[model samples]
Target chain A: MMYLFFLTALFMGWSLGANDAANVFGAAVGTKMISFRSAALVSSVCVIAGAVLLGEGSSEGLNSLGNIDSLLAASIVLLSAGITVMLMTRLGLPVSTSQAIIGAIVASNLFFHEPLHLESVSKIALTWVYSPLLAFLISFALYAAIRWIINHMRIHLLMIDHYNRILLFIAGAAGAFALGANNIANVVGLFIFPFEKAQVTLLPFFPRLSTQLFFLGSLAIGAGIITFSKRVMITMGNSLFELYAVSAFVVVISSALVLLLFSSQSLSQFLQHRGLPSFPLIPVSQSQSSVGAVLGIAAARKGWHSIRRGLLLKIAAGWVATPLGAALITYVSFSFLSLFIDL
Target chain B: MKLFTGKNKMLMSNIDSFLQLIGDSSTYFHKALESYLSSDENTFTEYLKKVSVIEHEADELLKKVKHDLYAFMLIPDTRADVFRFINDLDNIIDSSKQLLVQLSIQRPLFSPSLSDGIISLVTVNCESMKALIETASVFFRQPSLVENRALAVIRCEEKVDAIGERIEREIFSLESSYSLSEKMQLSQFNRQICSLSDLAEDIARDLIIFALKRMV
Candidate 1:
């Protein structure tokens, strides 16, 4: 019976892998620089590695958003978030799973009469707002630096092409790792609170069962990538203004950096040890960061006129709709589940 | 396995093969013209067959170059420029083939005065194509030498144009011993031969742009 509740978490993991994996390798696959088969393989391996090793830091942040004492409530929240994400993905909008799960958690908190941690919620909210803008600024600066290097170095065009492909593969792998690290919390963090007393040892040398569960969730995400990410990959590759291979490389690297900064615990601790303020470890929207980086490159290349404003507006609309849509779905689903199940 | 092989080497090989085929086509065009002027019907047929074969080979290489460019990631900055440049070079080969075919079919009688000028135009155009091939090859190896070769192509094109125009003027200024239709045919043939040089000049100009892009 307890295993039934875990299915929702796995479903959420699958949804994330199906959708968010596109953020990691979409540009590479879309531009035909990397084959979809290779992209999926690398993404799955890197994402699982990231989730198993570095997932705990941002999971701590997500855990503080709301503490749901009931297992049923946790299952419903994940299900609602997963459903909302799946819906938005079907509509071809790259909505963030981080936003969806947070919205679902906040709604479940309200539904269960749990007290909301306004400070943690607001901090996470602020990062959501700041991440895309940071990604844009970083991408703009990075592109300018790269262009300067290319011009001054006078590298042969063929060499630049070869270098771009190599760099893109590295960046895509890093981005996949960052996505798995930061966003695994959205899939399995809620279940951690309910499973606190049910720890099982997977390996004597490894940590507790909670980490094992996170690995399982991440594996489900990888399964999702293998099974259902091809269409989204194609859409991402061709839909936006034709991305040059260099611009695609810049966007992936910059967004990966932004995701890494928000989720790297060691970086935060290092800053804190130096008596400097550290960035809050928060789960940020990889989709927003990727789009923001693309926009930065576009603006740098042709100014605002070159940007596809309609596509931007549609994505922005999906961003606004995601959290609200997930919140409402969580509220309604929880009410329905309460009639047949103990809360 | 394919990725480990340097794409530069592959791109260069495809380009070299394409240039070689274009050279063969130009050779056949020159031979066909020589056969026509010397009234060797059997040799003209043989040269026409050779031009046709070389043109087909050039077309095949062009298709391979295009497929490889799309399939493998070449230099991002100049991939499109290289594609357009190769396309223009292909046009030069295509013009040579078309010129040979017209010469074989029309068999326009060239007056002795126009024969020398026509031969000179073909020779100069062939030199222009040869210069372009050198410029392109140098562009891949030593970009610094491309400018001098490209200038030579321009110079050859100008000579071809001068000879072509003079021949046309000579044909029109001929007495009624040449029919109106015959003079028009001669003038058309002269323009067709000049067009080969014109196409080479266009490609040379594009090569200069590609070279400048690389230097910057």
Candidate 2:
């Protein structure tokens, strides 16, 4: 029964991998700086490593928004998020897995009559906006600095090409790692702590059940990358960003750094110890940060006018629609499922 | 790392060799014409053969560089610009070889009195080509200097234009010393030689644009 419910969380992970992996390596593959095969392989491996190793921070943050203590509630939340992502996508409605999972968790918490952690919820909400803004600022400075360094280096064009290929590969890998580290929480965070006592001896290397769950979730994400990410990498990567190889490098690295900033527990501790403002560890949208990074490049090339107001409106619309759509579906389904099962 | 760096260096060397051949072809074409004007027919024949060889070598280098560029998918962003620039640069050697070939076959005796004007035109044309070569060589390494060198080509073309007009005057006025057919042949050579500097100037103009568009 538990294994059957676990498939929903895997579906969320798979959907994320199919779509968001392009945010990391799409430009590289589109520019032909990196082939799709190498990109998918490196991305799949790094995502799993990041999820198993550093995915705990955001998982805790996501759990705080609405902690689901019961197995039935946790599985229900995961199923709702999975359904919302697929259904909304099928209807051509804007959706993000991060937003969908949050909405589903909120609905399940309401249905169970559990207290909401409004402080943590607000903090997580703030990140949805701040992450992209921070990416814009970071990439703006990064692009200018990189452009200066490359110009001053006076490298030959062919040498620049060779070096760029190497740098893009590294950036794409880092972006994948960061994606897994931050977003893996959204895939299976609710289920991680609740199932900590389960005796699962599948992996001798990982003794903790949370690690086992994260490993399983990341495998789904990895499978998604291997099976379905190529078309998205080719279509969405360059079409959305339209970046040159150099701009792609800057955009990817900036977004990766943003994801890392939010997901790394040690980095958060380092900042908190120094009396610096540490960001709330949360799973922000990778696709949004990538867009922000691209906007930063556009602003650097032209002025602020380069940012299209229409696109901003669409983003705002998605921010509202994705979560609301998921919340509405989760709420209605929970109400209906309550009559059929004893909770 | 070493593998890619080594490939980049080898590609750079191939490009350098190609550009050098263009330079050598222009020089040999001018030398062949100067020797012929000075009545050193043997030296003219040798230099004519030299220009032909240099042009062939340049074509080979072009083919190799293009093959490597596509095989490795290098400089994806700027490769099209590179392909265009190199193709135009090859035109310099092509035109030079054609001029040399025509000079070898025609052997139309250029009079000693008009040698000074004709030699002046060749010198100015060579100067224009040299400026274009300098501009192109630095295109990848130092784009900032490309526009400046391109300006120098323009200056040389202006001089070539002025000198070509002066030579035209000298050739048409030589009716007393030569027949009408001889004058017409001399005029045709003058037009063709002056056209070389025009080609150089056109390529130089495009170099400025290519330089501006270079990705760092």
Candidate 3:
């Protein structure tokens, strides 16, 4: 049972990598700044570092999903959620892995008559509102600032172009780090407490086996991105909007900041007291945040006329459907699996 | 017309004929339009023959650029855009030739501003083309100078637009003692110069857009 639960977390990590890394270097590849191979190599390293360093916050959020004592049930939920997101990605519909996992957890709770935490559920829903709104406001400000600098400084184009490349690369790295730290829970959260109860053994040199489990999850996520992120990168970069390097950088950084600010538990608790809102670390799909940023930048530059209304509607509908769709599939799969296994 | 095939002789041969033809024709077209404006019939006749010959030579040069584009399949650099730029220069000459031919044939009196507007439009295009030619010739030797050359070309194209718009407005307001048919023909002649100027501007814009895409 212990081994099966660990394997379930690994599968979840793979889905997280496939769906989320698209946010890190998708725009850069879309704008032809770097090739797919370079984006993969850069993002993989930075994502791992972010997970190892700042992945703790979301690990707690993952704990709120309730206990999974039956390894068979958890495995069913994991397999169903993984297949759902992978199929969506293959079809070029950018679905959220975080949403899939949350829905699965909710469905798993339904099977046992466990009450859902309305606070966590509401936080998840609120992210849907704030992410796009924040991205729109921030990108508008960034573009306006860039235009003002260009007009006032009268900087030489050659010098600016050279420097802008370096700045874009660094921003790309930060975006990758933010992705890992904020998104690690989508992979390893289910197994965090489970691993401790199971007494998973590791080398004596390492103090805690949980730290090793986190590293393993991050590594699996990196592998998933390296193997299958090219298609998503092209779809995100080219389909939504064509971007300049500066605009791409601004969107990527803005997305990472939004995730970082909203996902922090302390930040959310502080905001709630002051009548400001916060979102759950879970279900804040990086892809949705990125799409919002791109739309925001496009809108700020050319007004609402610049956006493709049909595409925006399609994306919004997909956002609502992904989790519900995944939950239904997982719930049915769990019922069928329970007839065979008596756990 | 020399038969020498040595390297130095060939280098001098290509530069002397092409450069001199372009340089002399650009100057002649510039002055012929001015002479036509001032109603200096003697000056117009003296420069007309030279300008017509220059236009023919420019046409032949453009044909070579087209031939070179197909012959060199790889296109050492962005020679297609350069060819397009040269074709625009050829068009400006073609329009000037037609204008001169019409002026001699019709022999109608014209408003001073009408001729002045046409002359200024032609001058702007000629100056822009000269800068473009110089930039393309030195591009390979100094690749790092792409932005500078591109900015200069863009600025020159804008000036051509400004002058063309001025000329277009002048044609509508001109008063002439010619027949209605003659006025339409004169108006069309003025339009040809402005359109030719616009053609040059389009080529320059295409070249700059292409070059920037490649460099950055």
Candidate 4:
């Protein structure tokens, strides 16, 4: 049964690599700055690097839900979440795997009446509201600043372009790294807990299995990035704006800052200790923060007409629907799986 | 009518060549402008030749840049912008050359201050471009120098703006010997040149900010 769950997670991660890759390119491709192939290549490398170096936070979240006590339950939870995500992917919806994982844990807990961590759940939901808002505000100010310097100041054309390119490259790379550091746990945390419980040798030379799993989770995300990321790259480079390097820098910096702040484990722990409560480790969607920042920049430039309200709203709606729909599917699937194996 | 006739085709073509050459000369002229304004005219004559050669080369390369851009399988990432920049620079050259060609052909005497102001702007513009190129060339090695020079370039634009205001006043105060149409055409031409210099200055400003990763 545990094996089935592991297989399901593998599928989820694979789909994630294919689906979420679109977010990386929407802007780059739309602007004709990069071809789909080039965007894919860059994103894949960056995503893989991101996942391996930063995959810790989400893993911890999966462990705290108390769903990893037995191999069978862990397997069920993971399998159910993956299946739910796969369905969402097929429908072309950009949903958060973090939300799916949490929803599954919540539904699974009902069967045993597990003492639910309402505090953590609330914190997680709060981030959903805060991350995008923070991104929008930061990007808005940055763009306003950039426009002012370009218009009001005296300068040369070529120099401005060169500087913009350099800044964008640095910020974009940082954003990718942050995405990996923050999102890796969404796919690997469930599996890691069972290894910890089984007392398995994480490494012959080292006894700490959790750390090993963290490394593996990060590597898997990196692999996902390298193998499939063209679509998302196009969406980012082009569809977002007539992005000069300055605008690109602003968007990347804002999105990365927002994701890192919310996903940082030390910060989360500190918040929990301060009587603010904890949030589950879930990959905050880079797509959300990036789009919010892009829109913020565009609004600063051309007012509301600059925003593609219909498309942005559609994507936003999908974010809301993914976890809800996934939770329903998981609840039903688990119910069916349980009927076959009487506990 | 005589200008448009077949017998004068050679003359028109010569004029076309001159206009094209002047258009192409801006980038190189900009380089010379940089050298001259920086008080370093060690290679002023060489700078002049380089500007001249660039125009000659543009005549040689124009068909090709146009043709290749059309034929190439343009990587989606690099297509629009590269072409846009090249074309825009080319248009600036064409307009500048045409202005000179018209003056030579018509031999209409105009206000000395307006022409002097235009010439001065050319100097300021060259300063801006020089600063931009030097800053770009040494950006990674000395970000601050690039930034400082870019700031200086931007400051020079203010002088160009002041000159523009003076030129506008000159236009309104011109004597009644010339027809309103002629005055309008000449004023519009001056305005275009001023606007172009301002745009070049704006581009320089953007570059500096881009390098610094912060707006100054």
Query: Which digits, one per residue and each the tens of the lDDT, describe model 3 over residues A1-343?
Result: 5775667777777766775777777766654456677888888898888777667777677667676656666666677678778777776765767777777778878876778777776667666667766776777788678756644554433234334445556766787777777777777766666566767664455476655766788888888888888888778765432426456667787788777765566676888889975555653667777777878777877788998887677567666677676788878887776788754
Compose the digit string of candidate 2's lDDT tens values, residues B1-216. 222446667888898888888778878877888898888889988998898788888888899889877776667666777777788888878887887788778877777767888888888888887788899888888788888899999999888889888878888887576888988998898888898888888888988988887743
Cα error, residue A14 of model 4, in Å, equals 3.5
DockQ of model 4 vs. true complex: 0.04
Model 2 spans with C-alpha error above 4 angstroms: A31-35, A70-76, A79-95, A197-204, A236-243, A336-343, B1-5, B176-182
Q: Kindly provide the TM-score obtained by chain B of candidate 3 when compared with the true chain B.
A: 0.71
| Best prediction by TM-score | 2
Model 4, which residues run further than 4 Å from truth? A1-4, A21-54, A86-94, A152-155, A205-207, A231-238, A241-245, A267-282, A303-316, B1-55, B60-216
Candidate 1: residue A171 lDDT (0-100):
88
| Selected candidate, larger TM-score, 1 vs 3 | 1
Query: Clashes per prediction?
Result: 1, 0, 0, 52
TM-score of chain A of each: 0.91, 0.93, 0.85, 0.79
Alpha-carbon lDDT of model 3 = 0.66
lDDT of 1 by residue, A1-343 (tens): 6678888888888878887787668766776776889899999999888888888888888888877766778888887887897898889886888888889888988888889899998888878767887888898888878877765565555666677777878888999899888888887788777777455353455566668777988998998998898788778756531436678778888988998888889999999999997878878888889888978887776677887888678667766888899999999998887888777
Q: All models: lDDT?
A: 0.81, 0.82, 0.66, 0.59
Q: Could you arrange the candidates by lDDT from highest to lowest? A: 2, 1, 3, 4
- Per-candidate iRMS values, in order, are 4.5, 3.9, 16.6, 16.4
TM-score of each: 0.82, 0.92, 0.64, 0.61
Could you give candidate 4's per-residue lDDT for residues B97-147 as a string of tens digits? 554445435544456655566567677765654554454433423444656
lDDT, residue A72, model 2: 71
Deviation from native of the Cα of residue A38 in model 3, angstroms? 3.9
DockQ winner: 2
